[model samples]
Target chain A: MRGTPRLVAALCTVVVALLLQVTVFPHLAWNGVVPDLVLLAVVGAALVTDARFATLLGFGAGLLLDVAPPADHAAGRWALALLVVGYVVGRVAHDHQPGGQRPSYPVMLAAGAAGAFVGTSLFALSGLVLRDPAVGVGELLEVVLAAVAYDVLAAVVVVPATVWLFTREPGPRPAQVTPRLPRRTPV
Target chain B: MSLDTRPPRQRPVRQVSTPRERLEASGMPSRSLLVALVLACVALMVVDLSGGKDSPIAPVRRVVGEVIGPAQAAVSEVMGPIVGLPGALRTNDALRDDLAVAKDRNADLEAELERAGYNDNRYDEFAGMCQMIGDLGYAVSPAHVIGYGSAQSFSDTVTIDAGSDAGLRPDMTVLNNDGLVGRVLAVTSETATVLLIIDPASTVGGRVGDNMENGMVDGQGGFEADRPLELRLLDNTVVPQKGQAVVTWGSEGGAPYVSGVPIGEVSKTFEELRLGTFRAVLEPYVDFTSLGLVGVVVPAGDDQRVIAADCVPGGTR
Candidate 1:
């Protein structure tokens, strides 16, 4: 029950992000590479959620990407890659201690960059393994670097906001204290 | 002994594990569950990679596509007008310049018409006849591009709003004003997917210029923004020269592409001495990066109007 609202919000975010990824991002592509907003969202989700949840989210997100139009590769390659990403990011997130604490900007940026690198690498590897490798190693490396840089930059803004929005539990209002009135001098 | 002044040193207590601790030790949120999901995904991948269109995943993919395709179409429809604004503005500027020239031409044409005493009705009829003759050979349906491939792996395709509802079918040739764009790959009730000629998997039988030398034009996966397509000649007797026009050698009755449609121009020619054949790199006529209004070439039936030979004076067939 507690996860319902967050899950809905996450789903909305995923839909919007996927839409933008297919539409507006193509216009903003640099060197034929657009930032993976969904991957960034997945990483953000992982930071705020448990490993199992992250894994599930990753599979769902990757599945959406796989089935989407213009998808040429085998289905589930992205799912596998992103599943690994979500689980690893979630596990790594546990290292920073006390749950529910918002990650700092630097930490979020690192996570985003690392997640993008890992996710893109795994995607490329999966492609090579499951399908024909249309791109070479050098190109693959370039794609990974571009994706990481772009994701890091995006994460700098998106991660903190997402963590605050989804992960942080509101603190209880400070216990209100009613101070005792000074004993009226026996009036 | 019963009332010892000093209390015995407290012994260290061994920690007892709680249910939660046990759950955490076994990997909370279910490690086995995650593993099962992963294995399922792997199995799906194996099935998908091993099978072609008939794979179980294809229908699932199609169903999922139908779910998202409409949303994408709506977004593209909204975005289309906005994306065109810049070009529209540029065109407006150009139109202003052309307007004065057009006015001058109009005045001249008016004077000529007065001198010639042109019959408006007869001229309209003649123009209609000419247009009818022009459309008799072929018919085209206009379509709007709804979306482009989101991932690099599938970068060579685009989705269009018009589909079987608009008479689109698989292998129908699509073209822009510039030249050949691609062929229809798949279609649903209201939408179709086109595999752009620039895709790596695409191969078009091409003929070079007036020499009519046959060759194959293949897409290079658009690896670099600079180079979009590649070409390889088949015959050794005649060599394809640089800057020669490349046109579709075409298919039977032009099912995939119409005969003699412009594909591209040769950019560079490479000689393979060992294979005794030449390869030509091409600069495609169509700028695939920015796609707009496209036309689907469909076969026109025998109901076309043919002009009478007697209509032309001093003209012989």
Candidate 2:
């Protein structure tokens, strides 16, 4: 709702997600696949927010990740993927309430899975278009599968929490009841 | 009856949509905004893909790295001990096993040393390296591997701790005790990304042992353990010899690599049906898989030292 608070919450979520993705996830990797916590956060944020904000969040988060270490490909590839993913998730899982409504867990989970798949696929496509030697079709498919699975699993915890935090607007209030005046002393 | 008169006189009211209702009607992210953002992202992607290292986002990338590098280093420091606990125990066990074997070897070496009057074979290794440094007249700086490239991209790169700060520059040759490792791809303030010779994009001019038959050694894009590198003979005049050693053919300026640096030994040969050229699969001397402490070749300042007279092969002593 408010600009400063929204910005603060977004920054905090993205930073925490980025830190965890880069630092902690590498150690937790299985089959060389680590959950993309940043993408999960973006989906969660998008689920509670609008498409515009979600797209912006995705772009910003993706940019940070691209520039960060261990990122071997050209920059902006991830940003494009994340931007598209954010927009898609925001549109798909959108809950438009005068008072914002957080998406249900199942919705969040599906959205997270879908977002990761789309994001990784887009990244792979961009790499392929650039003639990157690394982006083989089989490898890309495996990566997409792993990323989606991991994102969904992690989203079970992170998505709900992020949606709850971002969905700050209060729900609709009950109708007010006016008190009846006493029968004018039986007049 | 008196209140009814005023109530009846109430004017007709107009209903106005709330902000939320209006937003719902307008839809999330107007088409124009979405189009603008998409176009912007496309522009960025195009620029980044084509711009190489001189892209406009280079500064942004550098700044982000500088900010995040310290944080990552701190995280690595804090988490290293915890994450490495199990590995450390395993290493302890391995060391014990190695120690037993080393003790027997030590005894055998001691007996040999008593007969030959020398004990440390390691001395010869270092002496050879010293001789090499003297011969090549290139300053060598040792560095340790800090990180590997992202698995998702399957990039054949390793980050070394020594960088521009250590007088290491891009395209400089990297080596270990065995032989040529790779060349420095990019250097930051504190780290450098080394593109190993086993990378698909990597190609080096190489010559077969002694006969000095020139060829091009290319990476097979193979990551499997100890995959043999491919060397294609250029002249096609000489017969392919098995187990022949391959060394750098040397560049004009010795920027990326110098001549006489051993690459590998011929393992297998293949004849391309179309090209009629023989491609030899050479097993590289340096194990690209398990890289450890490595040396970067920097330029040696003017130092009056003849190229080890023995190295010149029958030239003036």
Candidate 3:
């Protein structure tokens, strides 16, 4: 995959993941915490794409989550958290395998868990600093644990699928020309 | 028959062509750019926090809501049943148990209604809102729950299909069939954001029982049947009893909440040694988890006569 196409695909994946995160995931919440699909998408993008692209993608996706309906927290909280997640995940994953080989499932899952923890903690800590009415010190621990667990479980399926989509080669095109048969008009 | 059909296998070769190419392919972002983006995020949060209701971020939030709100509503409508199947099945037995309890409550309400001589026409109205609306004479705009939960925060909120266009405004009280749901926090053209009362940050002024003892009700974060709202009576000497009905104490002009709306029933009572005041736990009537249709109380226009003017000795207005 080339640069522009990969960027477009990554953007679409993040948007779709965000939609699922806010809509479907809420219904499937475990212990009042929904899996951060957008974060997982960023981690997946980090594993396959360069650090720069993943970081920007993370910022944009996080901003969307922050501003999306039903969100009452300060804007940019997720953006800051996810930007860091993207940068760390992309740099670590890229450095770990200079050969550009696709990371194994365990490696990808570990990255997802790490990204989840980093993103969720950063967001929570900022909420605490801001004195966000919604963030209680006692509840913060439960939220962080549930968010990381759910993201890791979701990462098992989401990360590998994202990697395949981002890295898969285009299919061969059909032949555009036909061979000419010799003319037999003289006979 | 001589068409070339071999698979392209030069991808590896292209990747490893040169060290410079490998470095370029690695796609590591420059530290300066990361720092710049991080700084930008912090600035945004700062501006948003200090700006309050008129924050510059409100426009951005509104734009995002307008763009993505419909997609969320569509996904919620189409996928709600399918995704909720497992949960529905899990709660099926619990719902069966509730049926018996509901039957008993129904009997009690029916006898009360008989004694009160309530109108039959009011019974046809949807949910618990109709009864409250009838009793209180509140004008309410009905709306459907389109989405739930914030993507990254622990705030308990829901997006409803109605918005400013539907006469909804921030600070308006929202209720469902069962009881008080929450209050509208923000409104766009076609959708509104509601902050649920079950959120830890929420506090509502409540009046307990016929004595109408005033108290402050605080949410305990999450909504579980066992987790109830904590109520602290203003008068330290009076102790509220179990089974006492708690209702909203109505805000002035009713911007955030109206008076006489049933909030919950006192489940247990205990003395708070620290405050030396009697406190009680109230199990809210509305179930926050399975919210669907809800009503936003729209204050009646000045030109219209207040229907419940005589009900309260002093009018809410």
TM-score of each: 0.48, 0.49, 0.50
Q: List the residue pairs that clash in candidate 1.
A: none
User: Any runs in candidate 3 off by more than 4 Å, and if so which?
Assistant: A171-187, B1-26, B83-317
- What DockQ do you compute for every candidate structure? 0.27, 0.32, 0.45
Candidates in descending TM-score order: 3, 2, 1
Q: lDDT of each structure?
A: 0.75, 0.78, 0.82
Q: In candidate 3, how many Å is residue B209 off?
A: 43
Q: Is the docking of candidate 2 incorrect, acceptable, medium or high quality?
A: acceptable
Residue-wise C-alpha lDDT for candidate 2, range B20-136, written one tens digit per residue: 666656347766766877777778877876887888878887887787778778887888888888776767678999999999999998888786733243344335444555555
What proportion of the true contacts does each candidate reproduce? 0.48, 0.48, 0.83
Going through the candidates in order, what is chain B's TM-score? 0.51, 0.54, 0.55
**Deviation from native of the Cα of residue B32 in model 3, angstroms:** 1.3
Backbone clash pairs for candidate 3 read B128-B177
- Model number with the top TM-score: 3
* RMSD of each predicted structure: 30.2, 28.4, 30.7
Q: Which candidate should be chosen as best, given lDDT against the real structure?
A: 3
